[model samples]
Target: MIDEHRQDLAAEYALDALDPESARAFEAMLANDAELKALADDLRETAAALALDAPAHLPPPELRERILSRIRAEAEAGAPAAPTATAVAPSTEAPVPSGGGRNLLPWALAAGFAITTAALWMERGSLQQDRTALLQEARELRNRDFLAKVKIATLSAQVDAYSKATAVIVWDAEKQHGVVKLNNVPPAGAGKDYQLWVIDPKYPAPVNGGLVPVNAEGIARVSFSPDQPISKADKFAISLEPAGGVPKATGPIVLLGGN
Candidate 1:
């Protein structure tokens, strides 16, 4: 039987905070069970409530200004600007002549060599800093791509698992962007319906994305903008409830995905 613990797990999955192995285990169970499906719906509803009630966090004004300035500079330059921080230059040390030949050329060569070494050191430091920044940017891009693929795969799996109808939801991790696609879902009864939920991992609860209806083809797609990145969520789900959803899970889950 699906219990409150499962409901909680489903909620956590929607938020994207579940450890990898646990999420996979939950998905495995979700694949074959109807009761869990209902629980998933309830969790989704709870998530919707959390999304609506949660407070929003805005970036610091100074940080925003800095970002805007950087963007403007890039636009003016028609190219990307160098990173703000760079590596420190290496220290220079005079080298002694090979074989202790006290020759006039040795001292002259040493001075020239020291100057060249200093220049190279400075250049190396700048290059190192640039490399570090580039690496960080690359990592961020990769993470975003990974989350996108995960969302697509999770939705596809949910659709495949349902013997009845199913829906796919999408959200942007950074901007609270969102959309939904439905398949094979039947229309709800009068005074009964399905509602969407967007769960944030950082928050203690879920949030409402919107409501959706099953169509003639048993498919529906809804688009929305969330308050934050969907990728940071534990999971997304749908639920059958009264015409409107409740603040917490009060019914069974319709769909869910996480990790």
Candidate 2:
């Protein structure tokens, strides 16, 4: 048996009054459960009371005869006909009139027309809601695409920075080798030539790679390996040094890289 909560939900579904998500869930339940379908059918019969009585204005005489003939034909064929206009009785209430002194027939027709127009208006509102949801989804997709492009641009900039810095020095981690690829470094005459220092921020002191001439350009690769692993270095720098390389750097840093 369907649970009490589910039966109530089925009743609401039969009335066509459930919210969208809840309606979809109930429809799925009805599709799979025969018992739920029967319960929904019963509730539908009950709610048909809203449509029980036709309006006071009768349909034209010929239209009424044609309707009755179709009903009689269905009865003779021994097939159960779907419910027809006969299921509803005519309303006896006198029609209310508008201020223009016209017969109530015109006003009743106008009111019925207005009701149909209102139903169409409600349908249009649902269509607009669907359109709004689609627009929001499109905006989200555009934002995602823009963010992806931004990420690509940022990565490209980082790659360009790495390339520019690599042009200044050629360091090979696998061979523990360092090479000076540039010549004529700045600040040449200040009692110091460019000296490479492989420093690890995790270590106490910088390891001397070698002293390099300011104008020399033929790959001044160093023989020294870094004291700590290269991965642990928070900073790397070239310092100005005297003719012979210093055991410890006492000069100003010329270039540096770090977080």
Candidate 3:
């Protein structure tokens, strides 16, 4: 049996009213709980139908009169009978208007409409916020997808000494920069650092990308901008060089990629 708390969670999930963490938790539960999933699906369908399928129609003109008449009849039926004997003193109370009860209908309708309009206005603001957030999230995803598509190269170990190393160079020619990621590569020897190079066909030699440092876990990620403009990055390479880096690669190239 789904408890009241779970039912409320399901309702909020259906309405997209839950916060991110709570929504994720509820979705995790739904994956394993068939009954909860079914209940959530039903609530979603019901909520959608109420929002989209309900027709807008005003109450009939006679509806207000009927309601007022019923209220008056009930009030009169509940009142005690008037005293049989008449007293001598005249009353001090103000006279009641003859149409006093009839006047209540307009005021009642006005109050009801005011409350309904305020509620609808609040709902409209909340929906607008949700739409803005969703649009932003979509834009971020699109940017990431575009970046993924432009990845120009993936490099692997070129020498048996660095056989376990894996590297990738994600270049963005438009921005004149790229990111290099290395995994399972051994740390550089003492007083030596790993250097990166970009072989541009226009240059006589490779352009010094930068020094790379690997953590104990053999993983390194560096954002690099080459010293020279690369008309075409024909190939990328990583080599062992003295501390800092070298303008020219004197050590063996351990990792290489591209034609």
Summarize candidate 3's per-residue lDDT along 29-86 as a digit string, tens digits.
9999986786576555544433332244333566445555555566558656855876
Worst 10 residues of 3 by lDDT: 49-58
The candidate scoring highest on TM-score is 3
Question: What are the models' TM-scores?
Answer: 0.39, 0.30, 0.47
Question: What is candidate 1's lDDT per residue for 1-259, written digit by digit as tens?
Answer: 3444665566556655468899899888888987576546544543343344335443344654454455445545763455587896665876656453565478658755754565456456555666688667654654455345324313322433354554445444554655566666766678876777777777666666666766777666666665334546677877767776565655556677543
lDDT of each: 0.58, 0.50, 0.70
Evaluated at residue 179, the lDDT of candidate 3 is 69
* Comparing 1 and 2 on TM-score, the stronger one: 1
Colliding pairs, model 3: none
- Candidates sorted on lDDT, descending: 3, 1, 2
Best by lDDT: 3
Candidate 2 — worst ten consecutive residues by lDDT sum? 149-158
Give the per-residue lDDT digits (tens) of candidate 2, residues 38-88. Answer: 557545543342223213333344644454455446545864455454564
User: What's the CA error at residue 9 for candidate 1, in Å?
Assistant: 26
Q: RMSDs, each prediction?
A: 16.9, 30.3, 18.4
